[model samples]
Target: MADIKVIIPAYNEVDSIAHVVNELPKSVSEVIVVNNNSSDNTVKNAETAGATVITELRKGYGYACLKGLEYIASKSKQPDIIVFIDGDYSDYPEELDNVVAPILEDDIDFVVGARRKNLREEGSMTPQQVFGNWLATFLMRLFFGAKFTDLGPFRAIKYDKLKELNMEDKTYGWTVEMQLKILKKKMTYTEVPVRYKRRIGISKVSGTVKGSIFAGIKILGWIFKYSIK
Candidate 1:
């Protein structure tokens, strides 16, 4: 069995973090929740729910994720796989088994849990978010002949393959950066359909006009920058 670890980047998700932690499959070896400077009960809740909680003073999604990676690196034994998921309870954490199945069963390098329209709850995704995913994925397909459809947060990858990507995005561009690098490296990857629902509280990114606009710019910037390279 592959030693699997999950990293959850939470920002003020106090209302939902515990549920997210409790629902993960038993196969997961560890659940690491990175509280991204949340001034709430997120840390307490996650710890109560049996997750190894860590704090990221920097308030970016990538910052929290990188913090988790650093913690894993400092451990005596490293996990064979790493899974990234949101702490908003929007994704079905129990489906973690499915998220990493491709990597375990087929020797795949990376797997993304695609939030398909049919499986997603009504209003789970905002219009801007929907359009952003479409535009970003379309650009990727046009530029690199890629088959990615959604920049979903629920995803998994092999530890060694993840290290090779040398991830550096510290904010809204993290997801796209990973996908772009996977394409650049010609790594084996696939997408698994996953159910999605409305998050418990307002989203830090898609719920605000400013956050949405900045996220779009960051995503596009990475795509265009990589296309030229």
Candidate 2:
């Protein structure tokens, strides 16, 4: 069986973290939850749910993910696939098998869990978030001839291929950065439609004006920078 590992970057996701940890498919060998300076019981809850939790004081989605990668690196046996999913229960964790299917069964280097509009719960995504996803994807198609529909956080990539990308984004640009790099490198990738719903708690990004603005800026900045490159 191919070994698979999952990385979840959490902030104050106390209510949702345990559900995300416990709902993962059994195919996953380990679930690494990186607590991104959560002030809640995220760590305790994750531990109680039988997850390997770690602390990443640096407060960024990329920082928490990188911390999880560092932990996996220290392990004697590395996973064949690395899955990245939000700590929020908005994403259906049981579909992790679907997310990694392309890589495992088709030899694709990466797989994105695309949240199609029809599959998403109404009000699950903010108006700005929907517009942002549309604009970003439109730009990607214009500049890179990419076919990505959504920059969904639930995605999977091969371990070796992931290392080759040398991802360095430290904030909201993480998802777009990965897609851009995949395009730049001409890597084999695909998207699998996945169901989505409102999270257990308010989103730290889309729920706040400042968070949404910064995230939009970061995402656009990366796209423009890569387009010029």
TM-score for each candidate, following the candidate numbering: 0.99, 0.99
**Candidate 2, residues 15-84: lDDT per residue as tens digits?**
9999999999999999999999999999999999999999999899999989999999999998999999
lDDT of 1 by residue, 1-229 (tens): 8999999999898999999999999999999999999999999999999999999999999999999999999999999999999999999999999999999999999999999999999999999999999999999999999999999999999999999999999999999999999999999999999999999999999999999999999999999999999
Q: Against the true structure, whose lDDT is highest?
A: 1
Query: How much is 93 displaced in model 2, in angstroms?
Result: 0.3
Worst 10 residues of 2 by lDDT: 97-106
Instruction: Count clashes in each candidate, considering only residues at least 3 apart in sequence or on different chains.
Output: 0, 0
Error of 1 at 34 (Å): 0.4
List ranges where model 2 is wrong by over 4 Å.
none
> Which stretches of candidate 1 lie above 4 Å from their native place?
none
